[model samples]
Target chain A: MTEVLSGLPAALGVESLLAMLAGTLAGIAVGAIPGLTATLAMALLLPFTYTMDPLQSLGMMAGIYNGAMYGGAIPAILARIPGTPSAVATVFDGFPLAQSGRAKFALHVALVSSAAGSFLSAVALMLLAPPLVEFALQFGPAEYFWVAVFGLTSVSLLLAGAPAKGLASALIGIAIGLVGMDMITGAERLVFGVRHVAGGIDLAVLLTGLFAVPPALAMLSATGKHAEGLGMTGPGIKVRQALGFARTWLRSGLIGVTVGVMPGAGGNFAGILGYSEEKRAARDDSMFGKGDPRGVAASECANNADNASSLIPTLALGVPGNSVAALMMGAMLIQGLNPGPALFSQHGDVVYGFMWQMLFTALLMLTLGFAGAKVFVHMLRIPSALLAPMILVVCLLGTYASTNSLGDIWLMLAFGGLAFMLSRAGYPIAPIVLGAILGPMAESSFRQALLISQGDPLRFVSSPISVVLVIAIVTVATLPLGRILWRRLRARDARRAEHPPPLRKDR
Target chain B: MSTPPYHGAQVGAGERLLVHAAVAALGGAVLWDSFSQQGASAYFPTAIGCGLILLSAVSALKVVPRRLLTSEATLVKGLGGLALLAVFALLAGEAGFLSTALLFIPAMALLGGDRNVPRVALATVSFVALAYVVFHVVFAQSFPPEFILGGR
Candidate 1:
């Protein structure tokens, strides 16, 4: 602990501080822009960091990592579009809050929750890196498969009223994810010989099409007179109301840190799981998908909490948990610093400084977010007609810029159209995204586990972690049925109470 | 009478049935494709296909009251907006992002009933410039060349 504090002085240096601020600001911008991602921004910055001192480069990357996670919520709250994939869960309640004229309040909740989560994650990363990395290493292929399955089942709550449609949507996503070359056999499985089919559908393109375009279409559907700025000047949430969500923040923070430490999972998965778990734990989940602040708190908190903890595996065991962590590892390698225990022993000051930078950057993000939010909320003031087109333009430009592929743009439009139809048909969209993200993870791990066990189906439950995950999956999968059975029993009891003939029926 | 229980979309039983049928057909198609594949590659698709079929069947058996997902007027307008987006995508490569966006913004604004042409034009120009600065200059990302603007 003292060693960690000793590094703080170096992290607080002027150059390092400036770099951190710049990265955080850039991260927020990139994250807030539809189709632009923190991974892309970090990848772009990786080369330039080669010449800088290790602390400066690491500080900057940490700032961006935390900042982008929070920045994604801005678009999610003000517009229905999630700026980053992790912010997808935030859209469940944040956008509704915006629609109900609580945009400021939602943004504030997201910002605070994000800071709280990131701080907790950074603290966990500092204190528990070795142990968490050891626990993460315990996950074998079978366990990873079960983890993916658990992730899929946990978010079933998002399906809520339309379980069947939601399940179908998830299946559809899995099917889409199945398109292109088979990862294991290198065979063309589902390609219909379309151009770029071999490369598979990009998740970014899918997300942009599914989440961003539909809102624009909805805007065009409305009449000229908008909802008078969607309550732009409405009262913000009170501190007391915000404090009510502290428990949610803490729980989501734990979920995020745990997921982050595990390989093959990322912030998006953590955020969704946190939101679902929050809904499940709530006494009344009726307001969950309808602009509940707890939903925003859980989602934002979990995603930001994922930021620093994701690097625990990378720094401790040289295993990058996610793409952002992989890039950070690359940055470290470029600085001639190899990750693992040797890194701590050899470069204690720099590594611990990096950890300090993560904590400080999170605090910096909270301040900057609040300052910028006042300006961002004015997005509501734009006439819906203009706002709609502007969003369309941003989506089009952002999609095109992502890969410079015209086909991807066309593909996005197709997904957008499909999403528009599915949403109108009353399907939950989040599960589809979840399915697409988890399908490949689940399938590959399942296949690997099978190969390892010589095709034994029981291999899935051979490990303790796998057994726990399997139980969790079964419980989550049956939650809807449990609710249905409970409802029926309650209704029957109500009926018996209504008519005293029920007493005679007992005889 | 008390309100009918509804979750997301409120549509006629026929529409719901049609959607379920479509889902079932999609599942069948996927299942059929999986039969020709080999090894672990086929396992996931097969599972997803079967799940889809079963879920759609169960959903078809459930009773739900009929309601409108959106008003007819709004539906027409929304479809129009989608059509415009399709047109924009097709033309973007040929006309370039700037030229295409220049035309798309005004068309979409007008379609959305924004009759203020000057305001629309200003917004269009400003957005184009901002995009150019951010995407082209800061990011150095390349876009399709504009024949209309001398290969911008």
Candidate 2:
């Protein structure tokens, strides 16, 4: 702890701190806009970091990750549109809360949860990285595959209206994930010989399309004379009730850290899982589908929790947990720092500086989210007519900036159209994005596990870790059916008690 | 998740039937496509496709058609907006982001039914200026070829 804190003063030096602040504010702006994403924000900034001291660059990227994760909730609350893919579930409750003019309270809850999640995860990274990474390293490919499936099943069962539609949407995402060159055979599987297929479909492009495009279209769907403003005012519950805060934050934060430490599972899974669980556990679940503060807290906290723990596998095992961590790993390499066990011995100061940076960045997100709440609430004043177009412009530009590729722009539009369709049919889009993110990881891991076992099917169940993961997945997947059956049995008992089954005319 | 207020083209009975059939057909296509591939690549997608087919058939039979229908007007307008975006993509690379955005913003506002000239004008000018400061000034990056200024 002392070592980490000692390194923090150096990062607090003027230039590095300014870089962090500037990066975070820019990230907030990018994230508040529909179609832009944290990954795209990080990718765009990666080049700029080449010129800075590695510590300074790492701090800025860390700030951006936390900043953007919180920023996405703004539009999710205001426009029923997710500014980032991770914010997709945030819209479930956040926007509904906003619709009834509780936007400020929801935003406040999101900010608080994001900070709590990030801070705790940062602390975990500081104190427990070695042991946690050691445990995480036990996960073989089979385990990784099962872990993703478990995450996917939990969220799928929690889908509100139609489970089959959720599954179909997930299949669409996996199909999209199958595009581009085969990682194993080096042959084209789905791409129709297009030059762009080799690079594959960019997640940012798909996310921007799936999330950003639909809301703008929804605005145009309105035929009425345009309203001058959103009619929003006042903060809705600035501070959450004490009990709700503790339970929601703890549950979601744990889910976030657990999922974040796993390589390739990513924060969206954590956010979705958190949201689904909170939705399930809420006493007044009618509010769960409506605007519930717990929803924002769960998803926001869980996503930000990934901010710190996602670095665990990256720093300790030399395996990037997700793409943002991949960029951070790239920065480490640029600084002539190698990850893995030797990294601790060789660059303890720099690693601790990174941890302190995560802690400080979470604090910054809280401060900024607090001060900026009222100002951002003013975004509702932008006329509905003009607001939609402005968002459209931002989305198009952000998607283009994500990669200099025009094909990505095309993919964004196509997915945007797809989002419009799926959403109309009342299908949830979160599962689709989750499936896309997890699809490659699951498939590659499954295949690789099989290959390692020389095509032995039993090998998947042989390892203890894999066995536990398989059991977890099966149990979680069957839980909804079990609950349904249990409810039916109770209902039958209630009915029998009410009628005595019978004043049965025969009796 | 709560559904967005996205009214797209309403699916009539005939169209709904066709749409469901089309979904099944697409699944079949994926299934057939996966079957042709050898070894590992075939497995995941084939499972997904076959599942999609079964799900689609079951959804068509069990779920009401009303759940599948979206608003026609919204659908047409949204797809139309996408066409406008495609135009921006085609032009932005050559014309410069500032110039392309200036044209694109007002055009979309109009498409979205905004006729307030002052508001449209204000948005165009402000967005351009903001993009200038954010992209060109602070980042010191090039969003170059100011169409009005000619590759500045």
Candidate 3:
């Protein structure tokens, strides 16, 4: 505690403070735009940090990390577009709430939830890094495969009303995810002679197409119709009302931090898991996908919560949990600070100072994001016709800027068209995104586990963690079925009560 | 899972069955392709193919048709919007982002039923300027070479 406290002065240094504020501002801008990922922004900013003092550089990174995670919720709420992959779950409830004229309320929920999650996650990292790192290390190849499967199944099965459509959407995504070079064999599996596709579909392209384009198309289709209420005005939800969601914040924060500590599982998975759990826990989940504030809180809180906890592994064991953490590790190496336990012994102050930066930057984000929400809610005031075209422009420009590949833009358009058709068929598209994101992880881990076990199928259950994960996957996959059976039984009882089952005649 | 049909649309069971059947066929084709493959990489796809087929069959049995949410007019508009996007993408490659965006915005706005030409033109200019400032000026992103304006 004393050693950690010693870092506060450096964290509060003028340079560090300025860097944090600037980085946070830049991060918010980067994250609010489609296709400009926090990962890309941080990567671009990494070089500029090399010559700065370690605390200052680290503080900037901390600010960007927290800021981007929260900023992602903005576009997701006002439009149906997710500014970042982690914000996808936020769209489930955020967009609906906005359409109901509760844009301000939804934004407030997201802001508070994000801040609370990030703050608690930073605290968890400070106090629980060692144990979390150890726990993360327990996930073997089999466990990782099951974890991916668990995330995919839980979200797909519960996100929509029809389990069949949900699962099928995910299956479609997996198939699309398979349309590239196979990592294990180094051979093109489903490229079908397309050279551009041999590199595999970019996640950004798919995300932009699936999330942003469909909405734009919908707005165009509804152009001449009675102007759909964009919910530019509504009753204000008090900050205290947002605070009343403490239970959801804590639950989702725990899920986020847990997933964050696991290597390769980032905020996207955490957000999905948090949303699924929130929906599952709700007694009346009919409003879940339609715009429940709890859903936004769950998703935003979980994703932001992971921001700091994701560093636990990188700090304790030198294994970066995600790309941003890997970049942060690179920053430390550039500063001649080696990672791992010995680094703590050598530079306890800088290490703890960075954690402090994470906590303080999250607080800064809360203020900025709360104020920014007031401005962002005006996005709904634009006519849907003009707004639709503008959204398409942003999506187009963003996708094009990411890789400078026109082929990606074409692919995005194709996905958008197909997505619009599937959505018309009543298939929820969120699972497709979830599936694509998790598919590669699942496949790679599945192969690795098989290789390690020498092709023994039973090896999936060889470890306790894998066994638990397998059980979780089964339970999650069967949850919809269980719900259906329960509903049928209840209906049957109701029918019997209504007519006395004609058995009363026999009686 | 017990929520009402999506969008409150009434779906015909036969239509749903047809959709499921189509999905099943697609899954079957994938399974067949995976079988022809000659490596460990095929295993995952093969498993997915089977799961998709099985799920489609199960879904086929419980078809509840919802409303025809997308009218013919809406479908036409949706297709038109896609065509507009495609044209914009292709044109940008040749005319550069700035020139193409200038044309694309007004065209898309018109297609979206914006009949006010001056307002559309104003929106077009403002949006293009904002895009230039954000993407080109701030991020320093490179756009394709233009026959008109010099490329960034």
Candidate 4:
């Protein structure tokens, strides 16, 4: 802690402060746009970082990561469109609340919860990195495989009303992840001979196609059909409501940190777990799907929490938790700063700077997100007719700028169409994103674990941690069914008490 | 899963079977290809494909068809918007971002339903200029290629 405190002055230098603030604002704006995502923002920032000093670049990236997570909730609340993939679950209730004109309250909840979640996780990173990384090091291929599986298990049951669709969506995501080069043998599996795809399906390209395109098309289709994007009622902020949400945000943040510290499970899992768990816990299920402010709290908080916590494994074990973290790793490498135990010892100042910067950046997200909320709330007043086209342009330009390829633009359009069709058919979209993100991690780990044990399946169960993880997967996978059964039994008992069972018809 | 019959197939019991069957076939293709890959690399894809197939089989039981896949207006609207985007993409490389954006924004607003040419023009011009100033002028970081502009 003292080390981090000592490093604060260097981190607060003009260059670092400017870079972080600019990155955060840029990230928020980019992320709030319909087609832009946190991944795309970071990917775009990667090249720009080439010119900056290491600490400044890393601080900028941290700001972007933190800011982007919160930025996504803006569109999700106001437009029913999620700005980032992690915000997908936010759409469940956010749009509904926005529809009913509670956009102000929802935004306040999201912004506050996001800040709390991010701050707590940043603190967790500061206090727990050394110990957590030590624990993370004990994880072999088998443990990593199960960890990813545990995340998937919790998320696959997210849409309990549509498990089959959820599973199908997850599988589709996994198949997409299988594209490009194989991790183990360097063989291509599903690229189908296209150079673009063989290079691998970029997550940002997919996100834009899957999230932005459909929404743009939807807005265009709805033009003049009905009044949408009406201005939100400025109910003004409430201190009591915020205090009431402290417990929920704390719980969600902890979940995020726990899941995020595990490699391969990123913010999306955090969002899914946070939302679904909150949904189940809510006494009024009807209010949940229809835009409960609590739902916004659950999602925004967890995803932001994941922002800081996801870096834990990356900084500690030299393993990127997700693609965004991978980009950070790229930045570290560019600076010739190797991530490992030696990083702390060899470059204490930079390490502490990065850690302390995360805390400072989270505070910035709160300040900027709060200050900017009213200004951004006005976006809802713009006519969708004009807004839709502009958003599409932004999406197209953003996606194009990331790769500078017409090929990616075309792919974005195609995937957008397919996503539109699937969405029309009631297929869950989050699973596809999750599968793509986690599929390879799970597979590679599973395979490598097997190889290490020389093809013995028993090795997974041999380790105490792996056994615990397997048990956790079973527990999570069965939780929905258990809840359903418990509910049914209670209902039956209530019905019996209300009236005796009907006499047999035959009698 | 209790999917409400959408647009209106209006019954429970197998409304989604067709969709599931379609997904199963897609999953099968994934599985078949994975089988052809090498050992370690093939492991995860194969498992995922199998899981997909199995889950799809279960999904086939819970079909509740609701709304028509996509409304005619939506289809036309989405397609029209996509067409405009395609034009922007093709022209982006030759006309340069600023030029393409200037033209594309107004056209898109028009297609999207703005009749006020002055408003459209203002929005388009300001947006294009602001974006250019921010992306190209300020940071000097992000620049997409343009053929006619000699970017390549």
Candidate 5:
């Protein structure tokens, strides 16, 4: 407690606080844009932090992390396009609220919930991180290998609807990860004599291309079709309304934080679960699909809270909780910080500074989001024709800036084309990105563990941590499948009962 | 929801088979390369390749399967856009930033179904000029010189 209190002053210096505010503002702007995410914003700003104090640097990044999560809600609410994948589930009710002349109320709900969610998660992180780190310290290479495999399996199985497609995407991602020099043998696997390929694909560049550019291109392709109607502009909800929403959706916020801490369960899942739970709990359930402030509040709060708590596992265990968190971990690595228990011990000041900054950043997000509500809503008025071109330019510039290589631009175009097709065919893009991100790490760790154990398969089960991870992985993967099967069976039974099936047809 | 009429259009079973065969061949190549590597390198890629092949086969086997070739117009547009992108990449090393971007952006936009060719061309030119000023002049970043037109 003394150590924590003593560290607070250095962490909360005026300069650091100011930086955090600025970063939060910038993160919100970047994240509100359809193609930009928190990870991209962090990666872009990382180079600028090279010369700053570690605490100040982390302050800015932390602010971005919290603010971007909130920023994603902007596009989700207005355009039915989620600015970040975490906001994907928000669009279900958020856009409908906007369409029903409750845009201001929706924005208010999102902003308030986001702030509340971040606050809750920041508290959780501060309270739980040390113990989590202590527990994480017991992991070995075999354990890490299993953890990575488990993360990949759970993410692929649950997140992507088609198991086969998800596995394929994961495999492709691993293949991409194999593009650079081999870690153990020092052999170039698939460089094809290209020096840039030898360095391997940057996760930042891959993400910018895979997630950002393709969607922008897709938008451009469909730009001729205009978005109909105007978003609402009014005084929004009164204090009493907002407070009522907060009181009603408090449990959803808790669920969000809990789900966020769980590996592989992301904001999308949290938002859906929260929305359903809130609807079920509502005294008047019919108000849910309408412009219900509580409905939006529940989803927005859970998603944002989930986003913050998702970082807990990544920071403590060095195992990313989701794709966005994985990208954050990648950014940390790019900044020369090794994630895990050592990160907390070696960079306690920086890590704690980040925790403190997140609280202030959440406050800043609330202020800016509420104050600038009109400005953000007005962004929806821009014609898709003009917006599409600008998005393309940003995508090109972002891709180029990451590597300064035109090759990356070509790679982006190719992937963009492939992604556009996949999306059109009803295959989800998120799992592919997750697979790509987790693929190499899992493969390398698995191989290393096997080699260390002289190719013994039982080595994984021998370790307590690995056994626990395997069990967790199995439970996560199987539970979802079981639930899905049960739902199908129930649906079949319902149809049979309703139709009185075969007897009538035979008669 | 009723299936769209475009769903049952001209892609036949043979073409679908060919596409899956091509994907399988790609997987095979990857698998062969993976096996050539030392230690467990083979396992990862081989697993991935096999999975890809399996998925591609499953997809191919579905009746009225989702084929790569959707419509003649869409196919032409996609191929044309891909070809233009390839040309742009090839020309990037030789053409100056302004010339390449001015030509490429409008062409790609046009292929993307924008009918206002002249407006797209103008916008592309304006954007390229702005980009050049920002990146080369203001930002002091070096770019490829106009080799085709000699010096700039």
Candidate 6:
């Protein structure tokens, strides 16, 4: 505690505070832009942080994390396009609210809910992280392996529309992860004699290319020209109104927090769940989907709550809950801060300092979010023709900065092309990105567990955690199959019901 | 003016064929390499390679019933952009940062169907100049000097 307090001055110093402010502002802009996600923003800013103090860097990154989640609502409300995947649910009601000339009301709802969610989650992180980490410290290699398996399985099952494609993409990601030199053995396994490939592709460059560039290219191809005519002209919903909405839909916020904490589920899911719950419970349910402030509040609160709570698993177990958490882990590693149980013990100051920074940053995000709403709404007026090229240039520069290697640039282009192709084919890009992020962890842990068991397959089910994980993997893998079967049976029953006369004649 | 149902079926077939071939070749390469490795490296890659081949085959088969090429214009643009990217990668080392970026950015914009030549040129120059300043001057990071343009 003393160490945490002593580190506070350094963490909250003038320079650090200013950096946090700048980062929050930048994150808002980046997250508001379509095709520019929080992950990209974090990756782009990471190289700049190489020279800064660790605490200051962490503070800035935290600010970006919090602000970007809030920023996602900007575009969703204004353009009807989700700035981040997490804001997909926000578009359901947010855009309608904007179209109804209540852009300010929707923005206000987003702001208030985001602040509430972030504040609550920050408190959760501060209070719960220590104990969780202590508990997770008991996990061995087998348990860790199970945890990774569980994470991957849950994400694959819940996120992917097609189970086969998700598994296939994940398998491909694991293969790509195996391209570099082997960790236990110094031998290069799949480098194909290329020296640059020996380092493997950096996750940042890959992510930036996969998620950012392809979408930018696709946007260039999309020719729908709708001028953004958003104005700040509706009945300005006061804080009291927003709070009233929150008071009525408090259960939705709790649902958001709970969903946010669940492994593999993210803000997008939480938002959707909260919105549905709120609508179901509302007296005037018809107001939803047509533009309602309560609808915006429910989604905004849940999405932001999910954003903050998703960090819980990442910080405690070293298993990221989502892509953003994974990116945060990357940033933490780049700053020489190891994640997991030992992180709190060895770097409590940095960890706790980050928690405090997140709290303040959330407050800063709320202020900036509301003040900059009009500006963000106006930014949608920028022509995609101009924006797309600029995004590509930034992506190129960011990729080059990661390694200063031209090889990486080529790799980015290749992956960008592949992603473009895959997306056009109706394959979900999220699974691929998530797979890339988690693949290495899964493979290394699996291999380590295998080695410990002397290649015995049953050893994976030896521990209690491993057994639970295996069960989870089976459940996740089979759930979709079960659902399909149930649907088919239901359809058959309906057919039988319709053809009762023919069945009676056959009998 | 309704279009034919299988208007793009030929393209789908071609894509499926190409993907299957690539998958098979890549899988074989991976299998050969993995088998040459010392220990469990062989198992993982072989498994992954086989999985990839199977998935690609499945993906290809799935596409056979539907239109593979969504838009002819997009296909041409995608291929052209890919070619431009390849050119940029090849020249980035030899032509160095500014020269290569000058060529790459405009070419990409043009290929992407931007007809505003002046805007494209200005964007290219500004981006190259800003990149040079940031990478070379501000950061003092050294990049490969221009070889074709004769700068050291």
> Which numbered prediction scores highest in lDDT against the true structure?
1
Model 5 CA deviation exceeding 4 Å by range: A1-103, A192-195, A223-232, A238-240, A421-428, A477-484, A499-507, B1-23, B62-84, B96-99, B103-142, B145-151
lDDT of candidate 3 vs native? 0.76
Considering only chain B, what TM-score does candidate 6 achieve? Answer: 0.74
Interface RMSD of 5: 6.0
Off by over 4 Å in 4: A2-15, A26-117, A159-161, A221-354, A366-374, A487-499, A502-507, B1-22, B68-76, B94-98, B134-152
lDDT of 6: 0.71
lDDT of 4 by residue, A387-443 (tens): 677777777766766677878889888777667656655675655665676677678
DockQ score of the complex predicted as candidate 3: 0.33
TM-scores of the candidates in the order shown = 0.70, 0.71, 0.68, 0.72, 0.82, 0.88
Task: Give the clashing pairs for model 4.
Answer: A173-A436, B5-B66, B6-B65, B6-B66, B6-B67, B7-B66, B7-B67, B8-B66, B15-B63, B16-B63
Predicted complex 5: CAPRI docking category: incorrect
| Model 2 per-residue lDDT tens digits across residues A326-346 | 567656765778666667666
DockQ of each: 0.36, 0.37, 0.33, 0.33, 0.22, 0.27
Clashes of 2: 8
Clashing pairs in 3: A101-A231, B9-B66, B9-B67, B10-B66, B10-B67, B11-B65, B11-B66
Tens digits of per-residue lDDT for model 1 on A240-316?
A: 98788889988999999999876546899899999999999999999989999999999999999899998886787
CAPRI level of candidate 3: acceptable
What lDDT tens digits, residue by residue, belong to model 6 across residues B7-61? 1212455654564456556666777778778876677788877876787677666
Model 6 Cα lDDT, one tens digit per residue, A275-333:
88888888888878888777788877777777667788888888776767777776787
Report interface Cα RMSD per prediction.
7.0, 5.5, 7.1, 7.4, 6.0, 6.4
**Considering only the true interface residues, what is the Cα RMSD of candidate 6 after superposition?**
6.4
Give the C-alpha miss distance for residue A37 in model 3, angstroms. 14
Count: clashes, candidate 1: 1
Q: Which segments of candidate 3 are over 4 A away from where they belong?
A: A1-118, A121-130, A222-362, A369-374, A502-507, B1-22, B65-73
